[model samples]
Target: MTLYHFGNCVALVYVPYYLAYKHSGLSEYGAFWKCVQAGMIYMFTQLIKMMVLATFFPDNVEEFGSYLIGDFFKYTVDIADLVGLHFVLDGIPGKGHSKVLTAGIGWATAEVILSRALLLWVGARGAEFDWIYIQKCLESNILLVQHIATATLIWLRSRHNLNNNLKTVVTILLVLSCYKSLLFESLIHILKLGTWLGLVVKGAFTLAYGLFSLSIYAGMAELMGIY
Candidate 1:
């Protein structure tokens, strides 16, 4: 039974990534190694984030104000993800959509494997049943959407001929996406949200961002003749 449960969790977590790579036409481009390269960069970015946190933010605080200050700085470090994405986009060789999909999928896959694989291995295979593992799988799906939207926006921002107005909006959206967890944390604290409720809210947020990103991308593709 444990093995069965673990298999289900693994499928829930990973099968979408496989399906995405196969069906998104990235396979035809033979972009596998490119994605592997992006994933390696993702891991390196994470390692740097960890080292920075450990080196500079060594002390933990008990007070709420101090905690908030510390967390804000920690979240600031997440800006490195954009820098990492920039690097991922820089060297990728393909059309606009392919580059975006490759970078997004690779980055998200690396994150899920590094972050959730161990948790699923230990908890999902245990004799005890828990809804957290299931919730985590659902969360992973949302994260995948968020990452792809982020990649599209980053790629869009790179085109020098883009309208300044669109560039500004994209920059704002990128910052919002980067620090969305901080906003969600505040809302959860203020609203006293439950676990499942927070997940629902997060899904809603991801959906909104994704729709906006798609609209912007469509306009840009038409404008720039990226096809």
Candidate 2:
């Protein structure tokens, strides 16, 4: 197997154990299990969405550059996926935001493995040394971090009082999550610049996204008193 496949291969095993360890000692193990369930649900939701849309829309890989049409589906899938996490977390009981963390871990861990890793292994086999893959990995990590924060923020949404400010904040976060998801999945189409230039552009976007994610995560952290 190629190095890309190997990395994804190792991750398939490593990520589960790693996330399990991270989920350990912090919350009920059941929360992690629920997270897994939610992840499965989210995956199926996307698959169904794709299956239905395939009747009308072009295959995303082939027509990803058709910004207007492609993005509608992208936004639909991403929003549904992220918002579905909100309902998933809300279904679970117990407070203190550990459940939120568990849910995020579950969601991120599942996506990184099932979607990112597997897709890269299958489609990017020959391009083991490609800069795009590195960019893809970076975007995945950023989104993973954002997913954790999204869970916490969504969890926070209900716990907080009914106020305009809180509503606005939650709205901002939800929008941010959807926005990031679209960009990460589709930005490659826009990165027509050569390798080095693309990497530079990707790097800049990733850095900005990381900082934005950190600020949101920090806000959630403060709410949880992690600081």
Model 2, range 39-70, lDDT digits (tens) per residue? 78767766876776676566564476666657
Position 173, candidate 1: lDDT: 92
Model 1 alpha-carbon miss at residue 66, Å: 2.4
For model 1, residues 17-64, the per-residue Cα lDDT tens digits are 899999999999999998898899999999999999888775674432
Model 2 clash count equals 0
Instruction: Give Cα-based local distance difference scores for all models.
Output: 0.91, 0.62
Segments in model 2 whose C-alpha atoms lie over 4 Å from true places: 1-5, 8-30, 55-66, 123-128, 160-162, 181-227
* Runs with alpha carbons beyond 4 Å of true place in candidate 1: 62-65
Residue 166 alpha-carbon offset, candidate 2, angstroms: 2.7
Least accurate stretch of 10 residues (summed lDDT) in model 1? 56-65
Best by lDDT: 1
TM-score of 1: 0.96
